[model samples]
Target: MSKYIPGNQKHLTLVDRIYIENELNRGTTFKDIAKFLCKDPTTISKEVKAHRLSDWYHKGTFYNAKNFCIHRYHCKKTNACGKIILCGVKCTSCPTCNQTCRDFEKERCSRLDKAPYVCNGCPKKINHCTIAHKYSYNARFSNRKYRELLSDSRSGVNLTKHELHKKDRIISPLIEQGQSPYQIVTNHPELELSVRTVYTYLDQGLFTARNVDLKRKVKFKPRKCHKTQISDRTVFINRTYQDFQTLHLESFTEMDTVHSSRDSKKTLLTFFFTKEKLFLAFLMNRCTEGAVRLIFDRLEKRLGTYGFISTFEHILTDRGTEFGDPEALETGANGIQRTSIYYCDPMRSGQKGGLEQAHTMLRMVLPKGTRFEFLTQWDVNLIVNHINSMPRESLGGRTPYSVALETLGEEVLNAFQLRPIAPDEVNLTPKLIRFNS
Candidate 1:
């Protein structure tokens, strides 16, 4: 049963039909058909293959029902026979459990009878684990238990030998000086300990000193009723006597420095006579004691034997570094001896009232922190001369120069050979210099 090949349907030529039969049924090839029909072998083959029809074929097939009826359906992206029924139970592919019981894969259940209970064959081995199941299990498994065990297992809990030595070495001196914790730590950084440690040492009673202010480098607070602490220096004053009305001019003098803020390099050293209310101001190149000694020497040279013979009773001063050593101020080459020097109590400005008041007047020309490193000696002399010539209220509105002349007398005043003020330069018209005493 061979399949028939079709040639042309419309106006079929006899030769083409004969060629097809001979090529198909008679085992004659298309090359022989091409030679008989005078056509290409490919053209003869295509003509034979196309347009062939069965009595009842779909398009081009013989009437063999068994082979032609077979069918195949294909799907490129999906399976053609998909399952319709879906099982709602938990899947075995789930991480923790298979679909044995209702509970999904979560923490392992502790009950023994349940079929999906954690098994030994489970991958994560989650059986009988309480911490994973209950939030309340946290307290039983805390870090405090571990820490307590660790501490109990250790051998020591105290300072080392080196640490104790370092602590003792630094703390001993601070305690001996009676210094506060704040003071000790600030001054000695190597201590490397808290103020509470010092406080504990104090409570244990370690060390002591005499001057608390010096020990701590700080002053104590005054009581509400009193502004300052009472001093013991007044007892010494009793030994010297309080009868100032009878004392000689040579017994005492008040000393102070005055200068312009613009010209602090040149200071005017003022010495006021306590008994006669006379004043003298000298130009100074520096606030050094050397400069002070030089001025005293000049005064001695001008005043001759009287200046050399006069006793210098006492010098009162503030805590200036220039007067740090009183011996340097008193050491004159010829015949000058010792002079008693007194320091005014801290914060007690009234103790040096005369000098304090003079300083206030000086502040009008030279305010605080003025540098004495810029002025010439002649400039200081002119300013100091003017100040001495100014009238003072303590001397009944008389100029310091005039008061000196009246008290010491013209001859003694003339001994120094100070320049006399001309009539025009001298304003006898009095003006009182008022200041806080």
Candidate 2:
């Protein structure tokens, strides 16, 4: 469906995402949304399915506890665990029975599996809806997910074999005719490649022309250290490390980003819940200010205004380019002040030493230079589950998940979908997630 898309089309902006969300809620068709957005129907279909999240309500009050078993309503069988005397409850009443019973089959709503692919536009009343899991397309979440995907897709070599061959046909001939790559690109601007990129392709042996062919290419050595200046000089008044020290806050969340390599666009936006000793990380394709804002939006959406404020009372982070916009991080989407953000002193990563220590454990699973391109949020969650499950000496041998549960409670933990893995089952190695790459 996307094969013949309009050539000049741009990505769906935040406004477009909001419009899609509103239309979805209004029971609009994918074809209609696609036509309105100037996108293919398949694109709309894929976006909705990819970014839709399960909606939640207070269990047993407005919504029933999530039970998806096909036999949940009619099953009269007791003691599916094979201990009829010991386990007196019916199998349907038991939470673990679904895992234990061999006859257990999941029941899902067909409407959710089809074209619309979410419960947002369903005709059935939300309360009366029998689907075990309810999913809806949220504008904010979808927008963030789309940004991450766009950034990911843009990373690495973007040209296909056909495109490369076509360009090579144009470039290789010019190089053979004693014209430099720069001259060739200058002569024919239709190639649409940078002179440095053409050189890179030659160096990588993708083009017929090699470094040997270019008279001066092989003479230069690659530089080791490239220094970058601090961007966006919006002086952080009263939000500095000194100011944070004056506050004398009891607990705060320390935030940082973990990179695979200096050149890799993929990064992990990490948060260390200091009080709970819990570490959470999200996979971001690009470490940009907009990406950081999206993450804040996601958290705000999950925890609400007061919950976010209370939880992330004070956030201490470094003055990286990605964290330039402090106001966006501190302010909620609904114009409510959510939390305070503080910047650490230059080169003082040890200020947030607890989070640095957490990074050590994170390195155990994803060693330095591990490409994060193949990892999804699910993979990140799996890694977090293992990292948080391990017993920490600082927490008096208690796992971070346990301490977090005690301090933050189950409701808050559910907001992040955090679950503790058994200590014995936890695997902190590259083997944990067998990457497709």
Candidate 3:
């Protein structure tokens, strides 16, 4: 058989070892067996020597000594012995001759030391062979031993108790201080742990901190999205997302409503400016079209005609009941077109993906199921300020408030009641909201 070249490195299978055993029993050379198995000859030689069984027995004992020899080839005095003239090689094989011969010594074949390392392929008959050494490979025993070693290798922790304690001491305080594992590892040069290991340790409860202590590790129920079918009366009929995209509006705002529990009537009206990534929040008594229109009117009144026109030239929003009245949201009280409103396709919130991503930060502060009934507009403003103050990597590490202040100017920000929090003061946790309260 031609040699089989493997394309990738892989572990030896039971079939390979069994093939080696069978070939050995058939008197095949290790070189030929290695060529057929696409392995090194030394690998085959080592395998037979490693797991081969050996046994010893007295003369006339019915013992299979194919691979067993207690003193085989070990003694050096056999050739120099005085009995060499009478006993010759048979003296070493005869068990009853001299229980203790001074010059008695055993010998191993040169073939065993060179290539195969076992007697499996030897042509010498086992019964007539002077050497009692034997080597036999068992596939079942080798495979079992391989599995046991593999399992043992993977069962223990890599870190010692002292090392674990040292890491726990450094990590626990940072976690308690609201620093993420990634942040801690990046900031501390002395900590030689990967972020994944820290998280794993926390998950396994090996540290003082637990998974629940990590804000992002806290699990929440996935938000259920009910697909709403559009009818002729649907506001989306006039201004579809495709129409809005065709206009190629560079600056636009994404609007969405964040509700509390079903038991509460209050909701947060979230607006995200795509260019600056500035997020704004308004607390509302209820999620109604009238309430949304009321906020729009208030914004128009505050920014006046031109400022409102510049700020909200185009608004993209999901097809929610709260934003059902596109006409009311688009038109002013005097019937002037203050802004244009476009609806994303049903169940396609990703069309306005910026606002959805911004909601994730909001979730960190006011998590889902939080009661918004007691929250006031001032509280919403504070949360929005903190969110806008966070440095966004996409914005070149500039805070949204800073970018908005530069792009929209101080007058527009003041009109919207948006203010920048200090870099260190900006917090995106519930604790900040509670502290402010």
Q: Which stretches of candidate 3 lie over 4 Å from their true place?
A: 1-234
| Stretches of candidate 2 exceeding 4 Å from the true structure | 1-229, 435-437
Q: Compared with the true structure, what per-residue lDDT tens digits does model 2 show for residues 1-437?
A: 46566731576788988998899888899999888887988778877888898764434422225446777878887887786677667778676766878888877777677978877777774556655567888999988888888899887678999999999999987787778987998989999999999988897899887778787766888755423324666657888899999998777899999988766789899999987899999888898889988888998889888888888889999888888889888889889889888889877889999999989989988999888887899999889989999998878999989998888889888888789898789998888888522
Error of 1 at 435 (Å): 26
TM-score for model 3?
A: 0.48
Best lDDT goes to which candidate? 2
Output candidate 2 Cα RMSD: 22.8
- Backbone clash total, candidate 3: 5
> Per-residue lDDT for 46 in model 2?
78
TM-score, structure 2 vs. true: 0.48
lDDT of 2: 0.83
* 1-437 per-residue lDDT for model 3 (tens digits): 12346621456789998998889878788889877888777677767787776543334322333323344334333433354565445333444323456543445667566656666666774555555554557777877887898899997668899988998888999899999999999998687888998888887899999988898778765468664333445577769999898999788999999989979989889999999999998888988889999999999999997789899999999877888778889899778899998989878889999999999999999999999977888888988999998999999999999999889999999988988788888788999778768
- Provide the global lDDT of candidate 1 against the true structure: 0.48
TM-scores, each model vs. reference = 0.37, 0.48, 0.48
